[model samples]
Target: MTDDTPQTRRPLRVLAAMSGGVDSAVAAARAAEAGHDVTGVHLALSANPQSFRTGARGCCTIEDSRDARRAADVIGIPFYVWDLAERFREDVVEDFVAEYEAGRTPNPCLRCNEKIKFAALLDKALALGFDAVCTGHYAQVILREDGTRELHRASDMAKDQSYVLGVLDERQLAHAMFPLGDTVTTKEEIRAEAERRGLAVAKKPDSHDICFIADGDTQGFLSKRLGRAEGDIVDESGTKVGTHEGAFGFTIGQRKGLRIGTPAADGKPRYVLDISPVTNTVTVGPAAALDVDALTAVKPRWCGTAPSGPGTYTAQLRAHGEETEVSAELVDGALEVTFTTPVRGVAPGQAVVLYQGTRVVGSATIASTRRAVAAV
Candidate 1:
């Protein structure tokens, strides 16, 4: 909606998406403490969760569902598990594999947040008469004095998760809540509160790495699914240095798992500079070749409203990535982002999140990167 923003309506009826982690458990408790009518809903996202951590922190396992139920009981709220396994496989899993096969690195967490948690789950909660969807995202939804809600970075800079939340639009923001968005709050403090509340997940370890790839072997996982296609590992001159099983298994800026036996004549470590799924080629070069001069992102979503004109904003290329000053302009329906200084590893298909100070303005899927003239 043009000139539109999410408006916060009070007397909250909240549906917290619990993921069986300490952060989410505490976030749900905070929502309840705010005197809102809160219900806990845990998503069963795996069609067949590998029974590994179901007894602990695995979000898709039966233990994860039980842990959520325990947290809801502690908060004195009704808890239910929503079976979204098929949808998760379609939207998140399939998309991840496809993006890699297309020679682009994708963040599945952001996709899950955008398509599943906020869009799919929130839609269900609303149909059930819930006012807002709450979560453990380390980001703030601030209601400005003039009556508009803006998403901001979480107080704990180390744990801020607004980058993944950048896919949210005005409609989603209108019905979203982040109890852990407080800048002064830390994950340690949240866990301590859970202990005080006697919640079982207080000491529960935070889920790490990609959730679905059970053993975290992305290469093995993708090769098994997408199958291997032999390709050449070329240098800047197009001379083959070595060969690879598949370009989809590698990512931009990757150094390890190269398996290149021959070293460049210059005798410096090489890095993945580009991947061409069309030709199934993996290009390697020195680190400076990875320096990105500019980028064009497609289909940006503003958290509140888009900037009236082109201006400088802090941009992050990766989740928890360092911020760099960048100038942005709308060009031919794409967000053209130019950095005052070069940024590294700006992967296409990963979301480039923009922030004006602490407030998250919007983000877009990075379509391509413009390398420096020195690189060429």
Candidate 2:
């Protein structure tokens, strides 16, 4: 049995992943204060950290590494920087590009949590004799009487990150620790805690958007990686409305930058309804065309035991998206979910995470969506 097994009150050897942010720094401190033997490690994700964005917009930069080291010093824990640049590039970065190339809207953050943080990092920590991998994610881990663990939402719903972490399976949940999960405090309160703890990153701005996209220009980034292949943008009647440099630049439900030459007959704004990588074409239509009522998701990953059959639950379609009631069934490894009410903006390659109330049941990569018949 692992040292982190339920009912074990012994001091655990915890490896805290410090991202040079206030949350992680304080999480490490709290773990140490709770008598865990904690060590701080920063993942050097970018091959050339200098080229990545800096300050409030970036997560893995040279500045971030330095800040993590300083936080470790202040917390009096052993610190190290692991060069996971190769793994990160292959798993997260390359996958992000490939997904877009396939005309799917992939969430790199969810992929990173599944492929890099929980799988790669947790595996390495275990090999190095660490009992658990701790992070600053605002999600709770519940230990049941049978020594099993469950992942649940954080106390602060606004700050809850269980959606992105729904990819963690049972094995990963066993060795995971979230020190900031139960706190009902606000972001300012967390920062104040960091200030009181004498951490220098107390006022550091939270990183936003895709970290690797340094300038926040996702279209420009993809254009550089995938190269510009001018494609036609057509309406529902198969009439060309506009042209784009690449079909990969458009996502489902995108409204702006379509560069449509003609106005709609109804003059209602059109949205990106579909992107076809095979034909290199983007399809635009009315907002009603974007309504999705059902989804067929692949690669289902359950946090604990897989559900026995179809069950009613709430499903979160995106990172910050609201959860909607859904009836989910696991059939031949795919998750079939039907939302009680139709949802909009759902895209393939994004995850559809199901929840039984506040507990994260599992997540799957959205393979396809069924448009609402009423909208048709």
Best candidate, TM-score-wise?
2
Error of 2 at 163 (Å): 0.4
1-376, model 1: which lDDT tens digit per residue? Answer: 1012233334578899998888888888988887779999999998776632423324677778888999999899999999988899999999999999999899999999999999899999999999889998888877766867788898779889999999898779878888777746667877888999999998888787778877667898899998989999999899999999999988999999898888988899999999999999999999988898899999899997777779889998899789999999988789999999998877888999999999899999999999977634
Clashes of 2: 0
Model 1 reaches what TM-score against the true structure?
A: 0.95
The true-versus-predicted C-alpha distance at residue 294 of model 1, in Å, is: 0.5
Candidate 1 colliding pairs, count: 2
In candidate 2, the residue pairs with backbone N, CA or C atoms under 3 Å apart (3 or more residues apart, or in different chains) clash, namely none
lDDT for every model? 0.86, 0.92
| Model 2 stretches astray by more than 4 angstroms | 1-8
**lDDT tens per residue, model 2, 15-85:** 99999999999999999988899999999999899777755787999999999999999999999999999
Candidate 1 lowest-lDDT run of ten? 1-10
TM-score computed on alpha carbons, candidate 2: 0.97
